[model samples]
Target: MSSKTLISVVGPTAIGKTRLAIILAKHFKTEIVSADSRQFFKEMHIGTAVPSAEELKAVPHHFIQHKSIFEPYSVGDFEKEAIAQIEKLFQNNDYVVMVGGSGLYVDAVVNGLDEFPQIDSKLRDSLNQKLEKEGLECLQEELLVLDPKYYHLVDIHNPHRVIRALEVCLTAKKPYSSFLNQKRKKRNFNSFYVGIQADREVIYERINQRVDIMIEAGLLDEAKKLYPHKNLNALQTVGYKELLEYFDKNFTLDFAISEIKKNTRRFAKRQLTWLRKNKNILWVDFNTEPKVILEKITNQLKTNPHA
Candidate 1:
């Protein structure tokens, strides 16, 4: 039997990754393992742009809404669980699909996470205090100054991410980017990347439309329900954060919605920045037919049987 392969469908949000992954999984008669970190929480549905009920029914999906927001699910946890799930799936099928926009979680499963030295607890506490007192911009600015490369690739609006990178920079006196991809751990299965690409204007339009659809589907109500737990790491995302600002009277609802669209675009840009660094990815037009994409993937696999 051939060694198992992991087909990672990666792209910016709202670029139709879910649809493409489902098509590929169905073609391969396999299941999907979601790497979208925000989609892991059950409480965050519409905001995370999780697969619709119809889409989920079209293919068996693992890791989507499999955890609660109250739980502290780190990238390491996701990497372990995702690998276990993929291994189990490979027992039944030769190929399994992994899809998401969260580059860190995806890399955790693909390249393995880079190990960092343990910083002092006091340093974390001090950073948290600074974040709470001075705001995310303060931390973001510091990160940009300390590690401009990582700043371009990271979700700047995420405080947890910003603070984590800053902690490494401050402690090690080195740019956080310096630690990444220094060494890659071997995996049992072969990995293939399929990146969906589109024109910048088209991608932004798709994101704006998706945000509008989410609003129509009651994203505000969903955000309101999760607002009380806004401080939680899982809730510190694009849609929820903007809505929480409205709930806090810091911005009008109209302004908040616009902010969500703007921030989501920025998030997509960051995702593309991270993905572009991977020169091995097989880029395809976003509108390419599923059958064509599948054929391309299969041909690549055949030509590089040892990959």
Candidate 2:
């Protein structure tokens, strides 16, 4: 059998990754396995920026809205499931498309996740208590001091991710990043990364526009329904958290919307930081035509055919 390739379409949020991935999937006559962590829950539609129904109909997509917000779906679970799906896909197609803005999730599927020593249950419970009492800022500060490297790389706003890293650091007595990139699991397929690029100003403008669109599409109502479950790890993301604050009377609606835009911009910056570190990705302008990018991928596959 010929080797299979996993073509990863990755970029910051609101950078047109979904459109490009769809076009590429159609071109290759294959399905897409999403790596976007936020889009995993069935309850989060508008806030997570899930692909439109029409877009989803354009290509068969797996792993989108496949789980519930109440369920515990870790990156390890995603890595296992995504590889299983890709293995099935490779039986029919030589190339399979994987697209999303979640850098860690994407890396989990491509390179395999790092292993960490088991943490003491008391430490985890203590950290959870600290989170509830002192707020996420306190945990962020602690992580900054404990593992500055991972702090810079991680989504500091996500309490689950921040606490997870801290737990690993405290238990292993080493920086959380020290465990990363230690060893990669061998897979049956090769992976190639395609990153969408844009100027900082343009990216921020697009994010603001997307936030406006989300609000106009009744994101407030969607978030309100999930307000009771705000404490869930899945709801700890940027969009829902900001709007939940509005519902809690913590901020005015306008202010909450503004915060969403600002935080999204910061999230985009962190995404770019993570993606830029990968020297192997073929970067393309956000406005570049899909066919042009497809041609680039074809050339790459020609040069490195073996998976």
Candidate 3:
């Protein structure tokens, strides 16, 4: 590993991670690499809570709104791109910032993905076929039967995730979760993790307010424009998916908004569950000042230097 550090700021949605990351980037005079999966799409802006224009102009940012909804992007793809971007950034700076609430994408950059045996294309096609015909809930049920552990952990609402796990389970003749938490790849730079946290109630309320703000900012109109391609994997996001249901006449507008809040809270809970497993994270309260957090980070790095 080199003397460079990747300062990864992680927390649940609406937890002020972006603000903290910007502060760190400004302090270190480095760029930011975003790991927020939904924020990658150019079409998703308001609902994804993308940084405001002023904030984007504050520091150089990579990977945000860099992909189209029509394009297919995966965690593996992001991992490669992000590591490369950080490498480029580290040539001039000692520290780089990576910030997002997407746990899998963040972990992909920091620890590398767990290896799994490749399943046959035919098996995957069959699984997708099952999904289209049987609906997401059917495959979700089967996954619960095949690998209850992954079923509980994965976003069961996502068809891609559901089919991926099912194919793995069938081919490996074992639970998909069994393939996870394996050995990780080494990186060239040191990683220093920081997390923002708050009481569950406070976090939930913040999410609710954020969703309302999105709605006020014309998220419903944005979702309506994308409704024609609601089945696209990129559209399977928390804010857009609920509105898609409304457009499909399966949900009322009010109920859809409520579901967005409910689903976002669930996503935040899952994020916390994933982040808590990492013991190296320097956690701070959501209300904590950025300078205070920076002091804590400096103190830790004194003992655990990036070099």
lDDT by residue (tens digit), candidate 1, 158-234: 99998999999999999999999868888888888999999999999999999999999999999999888889999
Show pairs that collide, candidate 3.
Answer: none
TM-score of 2: 0.98
Ranking by lDDT: 2, 1, 3
Per-candidate TM equals 0.98, 0.98, 0.97
Clash count, one per candidate: 0, 0, 0
- Per-residue error for 66 in candidate 1, Å, reads 0.9
lDDT of 1: 0.92
lDDT of 2 by residue, 12-69 (tens): 9999999999999999999999999999999999999999999999999999999999
Top lDDT prediction, candidate number:
2
Query: Which regions of candidate 3 fall more than 4 Å away from where they truly are?
Result: none
- TM-score, cand. 3: 0.97
For every candidate, C-alpha RMSD to the true structure in Å: 1.2, 1.2, 1.3
Give a tens-digit lDDT track for model 3, residues 127-214.
8888788788899889999998888778887788888899889999999999887887889999999999999999999999999999
